[model samples]
Target: MRFPSKKTWILLGLSIVVILISVSPLLKDGFPKNHDSELYMVWLSEFDEGIRDGQFLPRWVPNVWVGYGSPLFNFNQPLFFYLAEMFHLIGFSLVLSVKLTLILATCLAYLFMFVLSKQFFGRHAALLASSIYIMMPYHIGLMYERGAFSEYLAMAFAPLLFFVFYRLGQKISYKYFFWGSITVALLLLSHNISTLFYIPAVFLMVVLFSKKILNII
Candidate 1:
């Protein structure tokens, strides 16, 4: 196994530091006031109940819409809530779980962006690109301002999907194909709107690299 070089580790450490600083606001005593934070907390609570009641992937959260119930999960993306549920099951409070999920998404966004950037650019440039990606106003605001957890998680998958497709464009292999498919699935589950937006870009990439794809087939 080829381990990262010393400089690569340093760059990764720096990236982690940047991610930590950017998410420090989440470390506050309570959830930050945001548009959707309460809504996510409610959803997560319902999801937890569903899980305990043996509904692995709950579509109808029983407590939503004044107990009349809403098929919220059936229509909305559940990936983010699923992740928060994992944290919740592990003993964290629902609010903390939600915050942790956002923090995790921030870390994933940096790591994925770094790996994708490093594939084309050097480690230093990758560090810069990832730092910028994690610190983008909209990226930060998604968690701290809007509490758009699903969309935020989707952002983490975007670069990973691009990296996978870019590799397949160069050379098709079972490894790349498997990862590409998984990335697409994760992105689709993460956010519907983001997936719709990304489809065009992915198609463009496929078109640009059609010759290579054809040669492989």
Candidate 2:
């Protein structure tokens, strides 16, 4: 196999550093915690039974007051629960489950941002942007203290959705459009409020860079 070039090695190294910084706080037990983390744990515990029975009970519940009735539960959409089901099947506790989802989302987002930046900006800019994003104070605060798992996951997918669209517009194809639409749908489902705003930002970027977009495959 061909070895990675120096630039590739450098970016990989930076990405590891960024991921460590992004996730370091969660490893500590001293930080303030989110109350919802407890509730989510209760919900996640039920997911495995749902999966085993071939039906999620929460879906069948009439009231679903735990979260569905509240603004927070419906703040965006129901995608987070669906995403969490995977961990539920694996028997992760609520706190671990939420953190796992957020950490995975954060990692994916950083990686995608790096790819997007490299595609649009350049390797150096991509590395810098990803580092800054992973190291951002708000993200750390939210993941550790606020326990904004849905927002974290949604935000992670946001960059990838844009990256796919950026590539899509360059060359129209069924796969690109379909996947782009799926990502948009997932984004909407995960957090509609964010998606409501995200969609426009993407549109403007495409409109503003119509020429350059055409050059990328």
Candidate 3:
């Protein structure tokens, strides 16, 4: 493996600092009290319990819907909860795990957006694009106000999906194709609604870059 240049490290450090600053409120005492914050916490708890009880892909969450047990995971996105659960398994509190999930997602959003933009627009523009993406009002609201964990996670993966497809367009390789499939699958697991919105955009990307794709096949 090759080490990144000093410039790359600097850009990465700056991006991390910006992302941390944007989400610093999450590190303070008590939860941020967003619309769906408590709801996600409950879901993460139940999901963890379900996993402990031997349910790998838990669809039915008991103790919800007035104890009737809603099929929440079956219909809703499960990626964010799964990520948070990994943090919980390592001994973090559920609240901290949730917060960590949000922070990790923001970091990923910055990293992927930076890489994707850098491919076409050079490092400086990539840094600007990623900073704007991380600090955008709606993106900030997703974590601190709306608590839309799944959607926020999906947003992080969206640029990754695009980057993968862009690479596949540039060079048709099994590695890129495999990762592209995984990215799409992750996006679907992250947020079905957002996946729906992004599907057409991905298709358009494929269309725009079809010549190379066609040549490789």
Best by lDDT: 3
- How well does model 3 score by local distance difference test? 0.91
**Candidate 1 runs further than 4 Å off:** 1-6, 209-217
Error of 3 at 169 (Å): 2.1
Task: Show the colliding residue pairs in model 2.
Answer: 41-94
Model 2 lDDT per residue over 40-102, tens place: 555555544455677643443222475454333324366677777777557765566566677
- Each prediction's TM-score versus the true structure: 0.92, 0.80, 0.92
| Backbone clashes in model 1, listed as residue pairs | none
- How many clashes show up per model? 0, 1, 0
lDDT-wise, the better of 2 and 3 is: 3
Per-residue C-alpha lDDT of model 1 across residues 1-217, encoded as one tens digit per residue: 9999998688768876898899888888998898998998888998899899999899888776777998988888889988999999999999889888988888899989989999879878988999999999998888888888899999999999988887887786899999999998999889989999987898788767667666766
C-alpha positional error of residue 124 in candidate 1 after TM-score superposition, expressed in Å? 0.4
Model 3 clashes, total count? 0
Determine the backbone clash count of candidate 2.
Answer: 1
lDDT of candidates 1 onward, in order: 0.88, 0.71, 0.91
**Per-prediction CA RMSD (Å):** 2.4, 4.2, 2.5
